[model samples]
Target: MTDVSTSDETQVDVETASESESSSYDAAQRRSRQIEADLAGDAGRYRMLTGDRPTGRLHIGHYFGSLANRVRLQELGVDSWIVIADYQVITDRDGVGPIRERVLSLLVDYLAVGLDPARSTIFTHSAVPALNQLMLPFLSLVTDSELRRNPTVKSELAASQRPMSGLMLTYPVHQAADILFCKANVVPVGKDQLPHLEQTRVVARRFDETYGRGSLKAPVFPQPDALLSEAPNILGTDGTKMSKSRGNTIEIGMTADATAKIIKRAVTDSDRNITYDPQGRPEVANLLLLAALCTGRTPQSWADEIGDGGAGRLKAVVTEAVNSTFAPIRERRAELEADPGHLLRVLAEGNARANAVAEATLDEVREAMGMAYDLA
Candidate 1:
């Protein structure tokens, strides 16, 4: 009888887990569709918060996955805020090496990719003290166990195999601070990152409930909606997620010849019959996806064009597609790289603008919590 009870409990737990996952997926889809409709009619009404950690230069994966969307949003007139989360770089690393240079390189990449400073406000993490100040109140609202349970934190801890630092444990709250500091109503993210955004939403709601004046004072932060990328998962030459650490990434700043060399080395199956079978032939399909994104066409169509031409033909086509698509951007990058002062000036202006906004938000937060002692 005891054994039967244990088995029944296990089944119940599995069923609960499955139901929870399904519910989350459904909610995400609904939110995504709503965001799309909103963007079409009133893109200017939305404020977006999205960024990268300054660990390294971005690659094609970063471009399609998020950067392209950012440029599109800016062009559509959305108030965009791009943060170089420089402080987050230490979450898993033992030391900060050449971080300053990496941050500048990231700025150069942003300009090269058409992220104009006039349209999008670009800032870094360490420069905004008021933004980081939100962490204290936010940390008080959640339990330690909740932090440990966060999926991104859990994975990072496991991968690093190091003792979880306080900053790492409270990483989600820091992200919440990042979003709420600027009152961003929309954030671009992949499906896997929905959990992180959800935590941010939780923090926003809890802060309002704990400190807000109900009907008297409106909420300080919007529960930002997720703008899921429609971009395909781009695998690297090694048939894995493209990442710098794995030496499988093709940096955006690489020359045409360098890009061609990298694509030439990409893996493909021996079947030799070119087809877009993402499940069965992911490596070949990845190359096709890259070409499709570059040319604004379908991956299957690219596959059909290269039918029976084998891997050699597919590689050549992809190499040309990638190089031509980015050739103009590389030229701009080279021109910008020559004038480093302009890049620093861009950062300085952005930092000043971000500081003003963050300061105002922090004042509002203090007022909400009745901690505005300075007003006395």
Candidate 2:
């Protein structure tokens, strides 16, 4: 008998090499398909669903993340829906009073930021009862163990010492309900959210396989592909995630003086030559990035313009840029705030349109699942 034994080191190297090759191949295939889809303009066949959780007033991070994308999508003539995710807020925080106010403030922010209510439907999660109802049937399709394995749920659980509630545990399922109810074919998502999109696709596939007939639309749901943005991640003044809780956010509603003060107090390195070194001087780089975004100038240009004056000149230029960018938004927000009734009317009209679409989707869902007779 011939003995052919490999050492553990060699075996490990072989496995690692195989995995890397496989990952590269898969990524290449995904890229090819994405390019094909883009060239074909297949996005036209799809409706888009994207939103924020409305945990607090909108920040620059929110603007960069999905809000700006939403505005562009709306302009592109894609059927778009922006949900103020009021329900999801409960998963992370307590008390609805603050959230309710925050939710309305978010609407004002959205309007001020140029989300035309005419072009896009802006509504709340709680207003869509049919959409919420779909959660029940969708939940039955997946296992508890599967929910536990979701990376987002796991991360949230790890962040806190408190026990995870049922709402928090199955938050992804609720998200699926949100997308599937709209039958949205494209969901603009960040890289971190790919897992949730995958899970939504799974629920759609399961529903089609289990109950869909040939006469009914097979897999009526489209596995939404991500529309990645080119915007840089705007960091908080403290160099953390730009959040209201951190007190580092430049609120869209702030006056010019307030905005200037925040920029002046923004964190930066002690020995700053105003270079854009995110790794070595994240705080300084972040400020520069904000200034660039506001002024419509490249960060490199800003760096050149403010060279060698240290943090003081950086602060001055940044404050000027930020004040200039937000001046219009502040004026518009104040105008909208003056007439609270107009905001309510916008929500009411949006709710009606959203309800009509959601109810139509729910009817089809019920018919597919043989529940139409029960409803009749």
Candidate 3:
């Protein structure tokens, strides 16, 4: 074989070839970004990401705070996504037997609340391997101090009553994966949840800065905006924050009898009159707020109608309104539960759709990072 050493002219051609490839890669990345920006402007096809943790069945707090907004957007033809963050459950719990049941129950709650599968996608965190894999790369994009300083994580850590685990520490990274996986741009959240979304934005911006226009960031995830809730702040029966763990919640899936029982036990003052004075009598006002929010009537109006009737009257009215408002949901939940096969099918199909989107995004990421090369 005749071997020819590289001459000056040949070396220049090789350098020119390298420059051309670099230019082509840069052009390709810019085109990808411009195309995504155009797609994002399609108002009719806007994407939203929101869902419940599988702590248990969602209550009215979930309804007014976030679920109602999700349903409205879904009906408006938006690409609504409901992520059942099942992996997040293990961050606080040492067991798993109950988690599967909670996931099923949460899915049932989603259906019962009118999250139609045809219009929206509902998938679990564990089902999409692509999402989990993303966290590994995304974790590097955020700092440890940033993760620890997150209020959401801190609150959960305190309530967990257990030492922080690695999973617990990097959960914000996991959350970024969830949002970025779908490339969701619209996020419905309450004021309390703003921090979580804010951290997601930080991670997205950091990832984009490191790899976006600057470095061909694949699947440039939108820095999601928080769609804040305009609904009234809902309080529990005991005049405290409404949560399932607090035992004061009126479950949306509960039968009228069960709902009535919980409302009857709700704390109220012995003022011998019904009033909406939250500062004067928070417990009594709490019941009025519940009924008002459920019925779309003012608490003062309720107090005016129930004058001198006391706690029994207020509780009875609230129980009636609460039961009536959610009666249809309760019925649907019963039907869905009886037909577990249908529920599983919906969830499985949603998981498939989610996996498709996530896998494609992951592939683009690999290709962008020059990691998709064939070793052979």
lDDT of each: 0.91, 0.80, 0.81
Q: Regarding lDDT, does 1 or 3 come out ahead?
A: 1
- Using Cα atoms with residue i matched to residue i, what is each candidate's TM-score against the true structure? 0.96, 0.89, 0.85
Question: Which predicted model would earn the best lDDT?
Answer: 1
**Candidate 3 structure quality by residue, lDDT tens digits, 177-263:** 899889888676655566677778887887776666555734377887766556667788777888877898988788899998888
Q: Is 2 or 3 the stronger prediction by lDDT? A: 3
True-structure lDDT of candidate 2: 0.80
Name the runs in model 1 displaced over 4 angstroms: 214-216
Q: Which consecutive 10 residues in model 3 have the weakest lDDT in total? A: 31-40
Q: After aligning candidate 2 to the native by TM-score, how far in Å is the CA of 244 from where it should be?
A: 1.6
Best by TM-score: 1
For model 2, residues 1-376, the per-residue Cα lDDT tens digits are 1233457667888999779756744564475357336634654565788887877777766776667777777766777888889889888667565876787898898899888998778899999899898888899999998898798899888997889989999899999988888788777765567678778989988888877754385765666565544558888888888888789998888888988788888888878578888788888888888888877788888888788989999999888888887788889999998988999999898888889988888888888887787633
lDDT for predicted candidate 1 compared with the true structure: 0.91
Please give, for residues 1-376, the per-residue lDDT of candidate 1 as tens digits: 9999999999999999889978997898898889888887799999999999998889989988888889999988899999999999987777767999999989999999999999899999999999999999999989888888789898987887668888889999999999999999998888788888989999999988988756327887788998877877899988998999998988889999999999999999898889999999999999999999999999999999999999999999999999998898899999999999999999998899899999999998888987888844
